[model samples]
Target: MKMKSRFDRNFDIINYTLLGILLFIVMYPLYFVIIASISDPNMVNAGKTLLWPRGITFEGYAKILEYKEIMVGYKNSIIYTFVGTIINLVVLIPASFALSRKELVGRKLFSALCLIAMYFSGGVVPLYLLIKNLGMFDTIWALVLPGAFSIYNMIICRSFFVGNVSEDLYESVKIDGGGYMRFFFSIVLPLSKAIIAVMCLYHALGHWNGYLSVLYYMRDPDKYNLQLILKNLTESISTKTLASEGMSTDYLADMQKLNEMVKFSTILIAALPMIILYPFVQKYFVTGVMIGSVKG
Candidate 1:
């Protein structure tokens, strides 16, 4: 190992110090939220719950668990995310592979048209009308089908295919009496694990966090996804806190405290899925993003 000079040692110390500070800056808020969610909200509001829980309680969690619709929302959100991501991959991967092929006629035109559509839309009104006409409104199809595939993701996948995938492999497959479908499933997909994982993560996050489509298309509360339900729950808490005119003072105070705790708890609940899922795919994410973006 090379021995560090005095100045080099000083530089290393400074670099580590700065990195440590940056880590704390990024992580502290999330840490604070975790503690706040369990702490007594009165202590949190009073700034007494800063490093640890002052009066630790799972009441916020208990309160949220009492809501029966949470399970329903979880089910609906899971279905939507799972189905939507599958639709995205089913459409995205094959289409991107096709575009990556030099043999595809008018490929440039097709790419250009896709880019145009990505930049432009017919706007929400026309899309809503179309969905209504197709009898997809108020249905799960309305949530998952409209934006099933993203052109930007397609571009990345195509770039990966063009740059990372070799022509020799295609030629070999062709000589072995294999068509595009065989080549795609047997060769391309197996080799494109990194990019595929990245796409799955991206699409899954989008589907899991999305609530705007539900707002626009869903008419029934039973069809609501988890994020939307949490959003409504937050709003309901705020409303109750604000409309405490006739309530006893002690009751009003309890509502206000519950409101604060619920806010933190809901945020954790809403984010927990992605947080758990990301670590599993994180190794492939950075590599895929870099290669896919740089290629083509």
Candidate 2:
């Protein structure tokens, strides 16, 4: 019994040690980014800052916030992310439910069409021209409309419904005279929390990080997303263009350093909301992915 106890103790130690190492591997990069963002850019370039910050300053954040463009960009990003996620959920939930039903007419053909779109896309120029023709250019709809339906997300959601939702329960509901909308609202949707949360996160993050779509569609600087504005800020800092625009040398130098810091800090800031929200939804994401991957 003593030998067996010792063996179990040793096994526990090994398991914990392995977990600790894995944790360090995952966390160190995030730590490094945080440190790098606060450390002096020269120190970062010199590889002197890793786990701890040196020459710490709030200048980066201050500069990023001081710019009117950055503020506007943040507001626009918030608006886009909120509105985009709502539209995504509204469309995706019904679409996924419809596709999950085997008895639905044209299911196979519709699924095939969606799958085909996953691989082939209309080229960028054509898509741009289409948006332009529709008079959606320079509008928030241009950013949100283009990505209303993600085929991959739809497939995952449909697969999750098939694997996780019991057809028996659905049939029982149907026999009780519960219609499609009623079953969806009362039964299927309630059980589909995991997949829905996962889809929301996926769609939200995509909209939040995406800048190319905004750059292509939006001509007005006021409509620029945070990422696009960040890109512009970086360019201005690097090229010393702010100085060329009649800024004082002292201000330019300070702005340049702050810009460098914010380049990394802004990424951390931009990513913070998702990072904080992910843990609550992470369990659902795991379950959803596992169920979605298994064939019914």
lDDT of each: 0.90, 0.84
Q: How well is each residue in 95-186 modelled by candidate 2, as lDDT tens digits? A: 99899999999999999999888899899999999999999998889999888998888888888787778888889998999988889999
Candidate 2 runs further than 4 Å off: 1-26, 39-48, 241-256
Candidate 2 residue pairs in clash (backbone atoms < 3 Å): none
lDDT of 1 by residue, 195-256 (tens): 88889888988898889999999989999999899989888888878877998999888788
User: Could you estimate the TM-score for every candidate?
Assistant: 0.94, 0.83
For the record, the alpha-carbon RMSD of candidate 2 to the native fold, in angstroms, is 3.6
Best lDDT goes to which candidate? 1
